[model samples]
Target: MKLTEARQQFISNWGAFGTHWGINRTMAQIHALLMISPDALSQDDIMAELNISRGNANMNIRELINWGLVERVIVAGERKEFFSAEKDIWKVVRQIVKERKKRELEPMLQLLDKLENTEGDKKDKHMKAFLDTVGSIKKLSKQADKTLDTMIKAEESWFVGNLLKLFK
Candidate 1:
């Protein structure tokens, strides 16, 4: 396929994938465009190419920036801001995993910590049941955290690819 067509295909596919991962589609598309483009694009260029409004483009661009997936660029003699994506796919995956863990898992772990330590009616049946359930949930959360740490660490090593081959 032609470069332009390939770029568009990547944007659409990545955008759809992003939606499933809780990121807005346009933000992912904007990142995808930057990832593939030979030259960094100004906000206006992104807006016109994506057929999105200035606000939409600006908002999603900011979101991507916050996620550490994109960065602002300044062209010589140009006052307008341009953006570019971190093009290494593995690095991108690492950032996404880090961000997701911070946003989702950390808060849940804190809740589990607080709920486990809360001293309520110790002799009450309701308190007993709640504690039982919370204990199990806390255990599960710890295991999930261990799994996440293992996965993240494995991604940086050769073992991940080796293990994937076993499943295949």
Candidate 2:
């Protein structure tokens, strides 16, 4: 297949994959396009390539920036802002894990902390059950938080080695 067709397929797949990570299809598409581009792309370039409205492209670009997967670029003598994705695939995965932990797991852990503070008699069966469930979830969440933290800080080789060991 042609490079254009290949790029289009990648962007579409990436957009669909992004939804599972709690991001929108357009955002992922923007990232995918930027990732594959040899040069930084202006907002107009992104819109033209993706066939999206300026508003849609702009909003998702901003969101991708917030998530640390994309960065704004400055071009000499160019008034229009250009953007690029973090081209290192390892860094991209780590950034996504870090952002998701911050946006999802941290808040969940906080809520679990709040829920665990319920003011009720300890012996009450319902309260006991509630605490049990929350406690279990909290335990798992904390472990996941730690594991993700390790992943965010770990070198790619070490992480990959240990991961592979699990299946071997």
Candidate 3:
């Protein structure tokens, strides 16, 4: 495929993938565009290229920055702000994992902790089942939380190498 076509395809795919992960399509599209661009793009450039309104571009760009996926760049003589994505896939993955863990997993785990302690007689069948289910989920969530924490701290090479060894 031509370079332009390929880039468009990538943006489209990334935007669709973002929706599955609870992110807005416009934000993901902006990130994809910035990731592929050779240099940072101004808000107007993003608006023109993506065929989006200025306000839409600005809001999504700000959201991307808040997510730590994109950053602001100051040009030597330009007064307008420009934006760029992290671009390194590893860093991108780590940031996304970190954010999602904090936003989703941590809260769910907290709720599970509270639920597990609900006043109930374990001898009762219904209470036993409820406790068992909550206990199992809490255990698994804790393990996953620790695993994600480890991954967040591990160097890319070491983490990837260890994971590969496990599969082998």
Candidate 4:
């Protein structure tokens, strides 16, 4: 495929993938554009390139900044703010994992903790079933929390080496 065509396909696919992960399509497209661009781009540049409205571009850019996936840049001679993404894939993955754990997993675990303690006699079959399910979920969530914590803290080389060993 031609370079431009390939880039467009990539941006489209990235946007679709983002929607599956609870992110808006435009935000992911903006991220995809920034990821592939050779230099930082202004809001106007982003809107023009992505064919999105100014407000849409602005909101998504701010969201990306909040997620630590992108950053603002000030050109020496330019007054307009420019944006750039964290291009290192490993850092990008780590940031995503950290944010998801805090936003999704942590809250889920907290909810399960509360649910597991619902007021009911343990001898009741209904209550027993509910508690058992919740307990199992909490156990798995705790394990996942610990594993994700280790992954977030691990150096890239160590993580890759250990992961390879596990696969083998």
Candidate 5:
């Protein structure tokens, strides 16, 4: 593929993948652009390159900064902000995994606590069934939380094999 086409494809795929992962798509696209760019980009450059409004660019860039996936660069004599993507793929993956766990698991664990202690209506089969379902969900969610904890602690490649060993 031509260079421009490849860049566009990367941006599009990154944006879509970001949306699926609960991130703003435009932010991901901006990261994608930075990843493939030969040089760091100013905010105005990104806005023009991506055709995004200034506020949209700023917001998503801030989100990326929070996630540690992107960083600001300073060019001599330029007051506008410039950005770059983290070049280390594993670092990016780790940040994503850590962030996702924080977003998905903590609330789920809280819900599990609520579900486990709820008083079920033993007199009603329907209520019993509902509680049973909740129990199963709690169990599974707890297991997931444990798995994520292991993932967060283990050396990067060790996790997959260890998880597979525990799968039964």
Candidate 6:
């Protein structure tokens, strides 16, 4: 259909997908809007376009900024701060993966480390089972952490090519 309709659909779908990534819908929509926009947008512009309140727009924009997906930009002769998304899709994915690993995987791995250090006797079957389970999870988490770190550092061409090779 129209470009406007396509943009709207993309923003809506991106907002929905954000929830799966531990972000709120509005934050993702704001990110989507900035991503597709030709230039930076002010908070007012974001609110009007997203049909959200000023507070909602402000908060989500701030959150998106914290996520490293958006940044504050200054427009010539404009007092209102404008925001823009990281237009490079590879950088966006890397930042998202970095943040997620820091927030989720790292903490889980820390807890697993403590768990594997249980004070109970290993002769107990339940204790043995607990340690074994924790050890397995720790192993997988460490592997994932390494993999994500590599992805964050990898160039897009090499990364995508390597992924394609894995499926071949």
On lDDT, the leading prediction is: 2
Clashes, model 4? 0
Q: Which candidate do you rate higher for TM-score, 1 or 3? A: 3
Over 4 Å off, model 1: 121-125, 150-155, 165-168
Runs in model 5 deviating more than 4 A are: 160-168
In model 6, pairs of residues that clash are none
TM-scores, one per candidate: 0.86, 0.98, 0.95, 0.95, 0.83, 0.98
Q: Judged by lDDT against the true structure, how good is candidate 2?
A: 0.97
- The lowest-lDDT stretch of 10 consecutive residues in candidate 4 is 18-27
Q: CA lDDT of each candidate?
A: 0.87, 0.97, 0.92, 0.93, 0.84, 0.94
The residue-by-residue lDDT of candidate 1 on 1-168, one tens digit each, is 997788888889999999977799999899888998888999999998889999999999999999999999889999999899988887888788878888998899899888978788888999999989989988998898887766667655565677688899
Residue 117 in model 1: lDDT: 81
Q: Could you give candidate 6's per-residue lDDT for residues 123-144 as a string of tens digits? A: 9999999999999999999999
Q: Global CA lDDT of candidate 6, please?
A: 0.94
Q: Mind giving the per-residue lDDT tens digits that candidate 3 earns over 1-168?
A: 999999999998999898876679999999999999999999999999899998899899988888899999989999999999998988988888898899999999999989988896879999999999999999999999999998989899999999999999
* Prediction 6 TM-score vs. true: 0.98
Q: Candidate 4: lDDT of 40?
A: 99
Q: Model 5, residue 151: displacement in angstroms?
A: 2.4
Q: How does model 4 fare in lDDT?
A: 0.93
Best-first order by lDDT: 2, 6, 4, 3, 1, 5
List model 5 lDDT by residue over 1-168, tens digit each. 998888889899999998877798898899888888878899899999899999999998999999888999998898887889987666677777778878887777787778767776676898788778878888887788787677667775686677678885
